[model samples]
Target: MNLLLLEDGDFTAADQVRLSGRRLAHMQEIQQVAVGDSLRVGRINGLMGHGEVTALTSSHAELSVQLSTPPPAKLPLTLLLAMPRPKMFRRILQHCATLGVPEIILLNSYRVEKSFWQTPFLQPAVVRENLLLGLEQARDTVLPKVRIEKRFKPFVEDQLPGLINNQLALVAHPGDYPACPRGIDQPLTLAIGPEGGWIPYEVDKLIEAGMQPVQLGERILRVETAVTALLARLY
Candidate 1:
């Protein structure tokens, strides 16, 4: 773990934390942290800081923390993505967090399978777990907000306009449309399709909802690969 992600419950005092389970094992096995050693730490949705190890045991580790640094800045981007399959869902969610996407909309598209929505990964607890893993990987304390939109038309027609307001919006597609812009210093709203890509009807609706179509060249990529690639290019 790049950062020791601490929860509210992990705090035993205002400035001290007690950690067990995976974190404890990670400290003992991977980090091999010793008493008086300082390690990078962050409170969830809070601040980045360092903790000095005060005590350690087989079960738990105690550290005194002082948070003085702010978390990393998030991209001023809202990602709209078709629901990926269960195998790719967790990875994509983690990628979103790692890439500093502040907001995400798990949208529905014509080519998305009905079974994809039924995955256990969509459960609130599971989603949070994956997002946390991403945050830990990126050394970020702020959690990315994930929203679900099971109905495509209503969400696209009713809610998308409000989200796209005054922002640069783009939809990733297969066509030879304008190349995806790079390193722009503007708020962005990007929509990516599913594995087989958005059917024509879905693409048209998204276009009508204010997202301009863009492309990432002729090579097709998986949903997870596309998400990381697009976010990297945009930022």
Candidate 2:
């Protein structure tokens, strides 16, 4: 991971910050940092700066961090994704982070298997790891906030509107109304569905909630592929 991320409090203890477990190994295996080498760093919801590797042992590493400035502004996009299989889910989550999507909501759809909801990757830590990998790739420190919604109608009827306030909302579907708009220059909420795609009823519900159904093409894309394509196209 190129951009090392710490929580706001993780950097508050100015004197010394200890890194253990995966983070420590990341410095060794991924960054290959030596003592006296400085690393690019940022707080989870805050600043970016340099952290000097002052001490290192097999157990942990110590750093002197300076966080006087905030990290780059994240793109204002809320991704509404139908839950995919575990492997595809990991890639999609990481790509969302790397591509700078600020929020991701994994929602349920008819095509989505009920068992997919039971995956351990839904745990906060696993989700964070996938997002961290993306941030590391983009050299971004800010992590995208993730939410899970199991019921489609409740989430769409109750919560989706609040998310799209002051934002353009688009739902990617097959054989829909028109071409997906290109380079939309505003805060956006883009929705992509399962491998088999969103059922007609679900699309109708989203439309009632102020979302426009846009088509990618006649060709159908898998959930993982569609997400990257949609984000790239929208931005």
Candidate 3:
């Protein structure tokens, strides 16, 4: 973990935090922290700073924290992603968080398996766990807002147009369309389809909802790779 993330429960006092479990193990084994040593630290949805190890033992540790620096700026983007397979869901969620996606809409597509929505990875606690790992990797504190939309047609027809209003909206699909824009300095609302890409009807519906179709080339990338590539190319 690049940044030691502390939750509200960890705080024993305004300036002090007690650590155990994975964090303590990381300190004892990976970080090998000692009394009087300082480590990078941040609070969830809060500030970034450092903590000085004041007390340590095999089971737990205590640190005094001072937070002043704000977390890195989040991308001005809202990601609408078709729910991926269970095996790849966690990694994709982490990638979204690490990439600074401020909002995520877990959408349903024709090719998406019904079982994908039932995966335990979609559980609130499990989702937060994966997001935390991503934040730690990126040294960020703010958690991205995640929403689920099971019905594709209704969401696109009723809600999407307003969501994309005044924003540069695009759908990443495999087709004969304009290339995805690069290094654009504007807020974006992007939709990425399922494994096999959006069907024609879905693409048409998205276009009607104010998104223009764009392609990343003839190569078909996996959902995770495509998400990273699209976000990187946009910002």
Candidate 4:
């Protein structure tokens, strides 16, 4: 962890925090700092700063913190992702968070397996935990908001049009479509598909909802790789 991410429960005072659990174990193994060592820290959804380790124990540690700096700006991007395989889903969550995606929608696509929804990683607390891992990796304080859409058609017909009203909506697919646009200063809603990609009918629905289909290249890439590539190329 690049930063010690503090939640409200960690605070004993306005400027003091107690740490244990994963963070404490991390500090012991990875940081290996002694009393009086200063570590970078950020309050969740608050500020970035440094904390002085004032006390230490096998089970816990205490830090005197001062928060003044702001976290990095988030990308003006909302990712609509077809639920990936259980294992890769976890990595994608962290990847997006670290890359500064402010919002995400775990969407259903024709190729997406129904069983993918049963993954424990989608649980609210677990979801938050993975996102926090990303934030800590990026030294960011704000957690990205995540939404799930189990029904594809309803989401596209009833909601996506309105979402695209003020954004550049693009669906990433491999085809003869336009290349993914780059570095434009605009809000974006980017839809990415599952393992085999969106079915033809599904692509039509997104097009009708206002997304212009775009491509990376001929070589097929994994969902996580595609997401990272698309986001990096876009902005």
- lDDT, each prediction: 0.94, 0.85, 0.95, 0.94
Error of 1 at 171 (Å): 0.4
Report the Cα lDDT for candidate 1: 0.94
**Candidate 3 residue lDDT tens string, 104-202:** 999999999999999999999999999999999999999999999999999999999999996899999998999999999899999999999999999
Candidate 1's C-alpha runs over 4 A off are none
TM-scores of the candidates in the order shown: 0.98, 0.91, 0.98, 0.98
Candidate 4 lDDT over 1-235, as tens digits, reads 9989999999999999999999999998988989999999999999999999999999899999999999999998889999999999999999999999999999988788889999999999999999999999999999999999999999999999999985799999999999888887889999999999999999999999999999998999999999999998988
lDDT digits (tens) for residues 1-235 of candidate 2: 7788776555437645778787888899877899999988876666678899998999988889887776666777888999999888989888888888989888999999989999988999999989988987777777799988999999999999888884699999898479999887889888888988889999999998989999988888888888888888888
Cα TM-score of candidate 1: 0.98
Return the TM-score for candidate 4, rounded to 2 decimals: 0.98
Locate the minimum summed-lDDT window of 10 residues in model 4.
178-187
lDDT at 136, model 3:
94
- Give residue 195's lDDT in candidate 3 (0 to 100): 95
Cα displacement (Å) at residue 200, model 4 = 0.4
Cα misplacement distance, residue 81 of candidate 3 (Å): 0.3
Q: Which of the two, 2 or 4, has more TM-score? A: 4
Q: List the residue pairs that clash in candidate 3.
A: none
Between prediction 2 and prediction 3, which has the larger lDDT?
3
